[model samples]
Target: MNQLERLRKYTTVVVDSGDIECITRYKPQDATTNPTLILKSVLSKKYDFIVNNAVQYAKKMGGSISQKIQNASDMVSVGFGAEILKYIPGYISTEIDARLSFNTEQCIQKSIKLIDLYRIHGVDVSRVLIKLAATWECIQAAYQLNKLGILCNLTLLFSFAQARACAEANVFLISPFVGRIYDWYKKFCLDSSYDAVTDPGVLAVKKIFKYYKKHMYQTIIMGASFRRIEQILELSGCDRITISPDLLEQLKTQNFSFARKLDATKIVTVVDQPIPLSESEFRFLHNQDAMAVEKLSEGIRQFSCDQIKLEKFLLHTL
Candidate 1:
């Protein structure tokens, strides 16, 4: 078997793209997308139909320009998600707007509306994982949604506090980013000894995974934003991993034996009690870690920027 097949023996591979061809080629169990991926996809000729359809649908709706933009953006997200679901049997993570990341009520309402769009397109709720930024309020929103049987995939998670909060809140899954963390360390940290095995990003996920296993938390830990196949390979045996098509292709071409890097047998113990990550505690923890604070803020800004660009593209399509 190729490296990808070997890796799948222990980890659940998720395609992190909206490109239908790559999804077909890699055949990952699940797929994920956000404003960034959807924006890139809408510009591709292959996905023009999705953008055009969303624009046409929103034009016929009775609403203000701002409302229409929101509607069209959501439609495009759902449209791409539904299309992706056609090929992957597991689930497609459809992100709620990043702008709603800090507003619990709005996040909950928008998530419900997005799920409704999936159902309208004949996709089952179980096949959809609502993606939310792992802010304090969003964690609470995930708790609310989880109680109502809606699964959530919390993104932009960086600090241990975020993971703890999400797990405590009964979130379905948390995506601790590896590549972005690595990028931050590379740029700021003077210690250049960090390799894939000791990569800050990889270590972050490992710490979270160990803590979850030791505590027997039911929330899943899916490592995200990998910069290298080495990072993905090192994270083998994580509950799930969302990978880009480029790295997925690299894994497919290389041949190697895969070892299970994370498992229940290797439980990680926390020295202290479960961390309290209330709004105040969350803010304090973030303030202490400059990397986490900067990365989380940058992540939100990037996603929100893509979201605005997408809205404009949809509006222009009219």
Candidate 2:
């Protein structure tokens, strides 16, 4: 078996792309999209029909221009998600607006709106995982949404604090970013060469995985934003790993001896007394990880910028 096929034996390989063609080719079990990816796919114009349909839906809603733009953006996101779902069997992670990351109520409302759109498209709402930044507010928002049976995939997760908070909130999944963490350390420590075992990003996910398994937390850990195939290989047995199309292609073409690197059943160590974090504790502990703080803020700003650009693109189309 090729590396990709072998990897699938242990991990549910998820395609992290908004491009439907790539999704069709890779055939990942799940697909994930952020504003940047959506913007890239929309701009490619291959899916102009999807964009136009969203525009019409937004116009028929008959709101003010700003509200219309927001509606259209949400529609476009769901439109891609619905299309993606046609090819993949598992789930599609549709993100909420990054601008609402710090606002719990707005995040919850946006998630509801997205889920409603998915339902309107005849897609199963249960197959949609609302993606949100792992801010304290978003975690709280996920808590309430989970109670309502709306599954969430908390993104931009960097620290154990974020993962712990999400698990405590009963979040369905948490995407601990591997590449961004490695990027921060590579620049801050002025070193770029590290093998998979020594990679800081790999180590971060391992720590979180061990802790979660040891405590028997049911929240799924999906290692995300990998910088290399080695990183993905190192996290072979994670619950899920969202890999970009480029890396997925590499895995499909290459041959490698693969082994399960993270097995929950193998985790035996348990903490003496584990306690959930308070809001203040979560913030302080998250803050102590400078890499997490910087990367979380930077990831949000980057996504929000693309989201704004996408809005402008939709406005121009309208």
Write down the lDDT of every candidate, Cα atoms only.
Answer: 0.89, 0.94
Worst 10 residues of 1 by lDDT: 268-277
**For each predicted model, how many residue pairs clash, with residues at least 3 apart or on different chains?**
0, 0
**lDDT for model 1, on a 0 to 1 scale?**
0.89
TM-score per model over all chains? 0.96, 0.98
Say what the RMSD of model 1 is: 1.8
**Which residue ranges in model 1 land beyond 4 Å of their true spot?**
268-276
| lDDT per residue as tens, model 1, 1-318 | 998998899989999998888899889999999889988888877888888778777888859888888888999999999998889989899998898888999999999999988887888889899999998989999999998889999999999888888888989999999999999999988885687899999999999988888887889899999989999999999999999988988998999787888887767555455755678887787678888888989999999999989888777666
- lDDT of candidate 2 vs native? 0.94
Off by over 4 Å in 2: 269-273
The number of the candidate with the highest TM-score is 2
